[model samples]
Target: MNIVLTIDTNFAPQAAACIASVCENNKDVSSISFFILTTGIKEPAGKKLHTLVESYDRTLDIIDIGNIYQYFDSDFDTAGWSEIILARLLMARFLPVSVSRVLYLDGDTIVRRSLSPLWNTDLDSNLIGAVREPTASAERRKALHIADMRYFNSGVLLIDLDSWRSNSIEKTLLDYCRNHKAVLFASDQDAINGALATRIKELSPSYNYVNSFFYYPYSALVRMCRPAQYISRENYEAAIADPTIVHFLGEERPWRAGNTHQYRSDYAHYLSLTPFSNMPMEQGWETYFKAWRTFNTATKPFPMLRYRIITSLIPTFMRFRAAKRRRT
Candidate 1:
């Protein structure tokens, strides 16, 4: 089994940590290859990336997709979200024809446990296996006028390349970009969903537990809120109970400086194992905290606030109504 990880050069630090963790944690996994896909990475950063990968004796392949804006011109600044497109293009370019099976992971994720189960899961169903998306069907994705529930998250994927190539998944994604450029969300996520919605096999949500605390309050507080307990709502807690791989999806990522998400420490634990142990963890932590505060303070909850007020008043009015009705 060829374990493959795809990282965009923009997120090189987390990508390096991700690669290091993969090397340290899953030492038993026989074949491991790390690919850093760059549109245009600086030479110094590229050198550091090469050095880190070589230190572990892992195969490092750097695949460049030229300029990202050349293909995804909808919003040039939101290029960070284009990992899916670049990854697909990179796979087509570098993945060997002999590589029948491969796994693709986001750089933001920390591999806590083994990947063998996901790598070995039955893909006879002609599907790319991934963790099920954990947010409300209507919220996480744009309102696609289709079914209420969607198939899976794209972060941690166990791909059957034979099926992928046979089905022309890459071409289909690019085709969607060509045809429906208007409604495409900032990232290639919508394109992948459109192309592989029905074609994907839903892996356990534990594998790609999206860290949206607002949507998944239970998941957000699962570990800290319930130390002796576990819930099956999202993949992280489920994986904690029976861990194969745990993915940190959404804004509250582990690598960020002061992230409040439940599994931040879990990610830190893996990071500490890396050679950069002496590096100050607080630097990254502070950046995450600032971003979190900015997001929360700037967010307006008009609808939710209105609903809360109405809900709060309902019981009082109902009590009065019931008393009046009894007297009558």
Candidate 2:
């Protein structure tokens, strides 16, 4: 299986944890190759990653994507996005032609099961296989002008390099980003979906369960309010029950202290198996407070504030109601 991850020095530790989880969970596989695309990662970090993967008898390929970024043009402000986020767009350029299929994973993800099934999936004529974004809605799709309303999250992708190259997917993605700077919401994700809208095959949500899945009633409430835009209840329930991959979306990482994700300990378990096991956890209460503040500000101020108050005052009962609401 060919697994690819794009990350820089800052996210090397998290990437290591992700790699560790993949190696640990898929030990039965005969050959697993990891391709790490980065602008520049320190030697020590590289060595640590090499050692970690070598310990599991897997091959690691580190490719520099610094020079490749120069060819692409985008007016969209990349404030929170990492430089390597765009690397997946150029997979066909960086990866070898002999590599027909590749599974691209973000650094903030942990593979909980063997990815062989995903790897072996037939893309047919599709350029990529990806999970539909959990939060994708009709309004958001309409805003992006995605006529198909199939906005897939580019975080975890199963790519058919042959189809991508044949259809010029790389250039298509770059050109889309270059032309539609104003419409690009999630950066590379928006570009990929826009360019290859009809060519993307929807994968099971279990393959790329986002952090929102762990937020309990909050995610359920969003689904209830926007049933047409959200993932179906059956798929949502299946993903929550047994996710193949858990993605730590946004800045609230499990490694950071005060993270409220239900799978924080699962991340820690994988972290412990890697070379950076002793890395210090985030301390200070300020981080937690900041996350709380961000949560309150995510939606309409009044409704979010009211929800916070209800959750705080009612607690257990409200949680039960939320779960019940999810079932119905």
Candidate 3:
């Protein structure tokens, strides 16, 4: 299996733990290669990562791709979001052409089991395999141009490089971005969904069990995302109970001290085995003090209450709505 990832100096330690999870869990697979597209990562960080991967007798290649994202137009940038979105979308540019397929994992993901099944999935005519994103689907309807079209998170992508190159997926995405420009507020995600919605093969949610699944019940989450197609409640519960890949996104990231993420111990377990085990654990007091955070958690049992709170908090001046307005 060929695995690829992108990271910066700040994320080296977290990425190391992520890689460790992959290596440790997929030990059954005798042939696994790791390709890391990195930026601004210095000596000791690089050295430490190299040692960890090699200890498991796995191959590791760190490609230093510094500030190349600056070449992209300003349309892709949002105030707080990093340029890492640009780098991740350009993974095909950095990976070897000889590699027909590569599994792209974000630095925040942890592999929980053998990924042989996911790796062996048939892409057919599709350019990529990914799980559908649940949050903010209605807000992205205009960007995706189809109400029923699936919008996927780029956090965990199983890319078919052969199909990508043969069909010029990269060029298509770039052209779409250029055409839509600033309207593609979500940048990488919008570009992928807008350009290649029909060409994507939806993977089972088990593959990328996101942090949201930990808090919201399947029924409540379904009402929240209102996706065109979703898994059965039983499947959702099963996947949540034993997820294949644990993705820590938003503020519930396990690395922070005060985070109440359900799978935080899993992250700690992998990190303990990595070279960065000694990394400090801290979360801002402000994060803990947020009234909304406490309220959100408390209202998890009552979806209606949470929805009302969210809608009230969002400014009316913004185009983004907390939830889709119901049909009469």
Task: Please name the candidate that would achieve the greatest lDDT relative to the true structure.
Answer: 2
User: Per-residue lDDT of 39-116 in model 1, one digit per residue for the tens?
Assistant: 666666678767776777777777666656565545433223443344553465567788777778777776666777
Q: lDDT winner between 1 and 3, please give it.
A: 3
TM-score of 3: 0.89
Q: Model 2 over residues 1-328: C-alpha lDDT tens digits?
A: 9999999887888999999999998999999999998889998999999999999999999998775548666344433455578888888898888888899999999989888888899887888899877455455466567744567889999998888888888888888888877656566888887778888888987898885455434454454234435556776677668898988875467877766666788899999999999988777745655756586457444554544553354435444544654575
What C-alpha lDDT does candidate 1 achieve relative to the native structure? 0.59
TM-score of each: 0.71, 0.83, 0.89
Candidate 2 Cα misplacement greater than 4 A, ranges: 74-76, 137-139, 216-232, 284-328
Report, for every candidate in turn, its global Cα lDDT versus the true structure: 0.59, 0.78, 0.77
Among these predictions, the greatest TM-score belongs to 3
User: Scored by Cα lDDT, where does model 2 land?
Assistant: 0.78
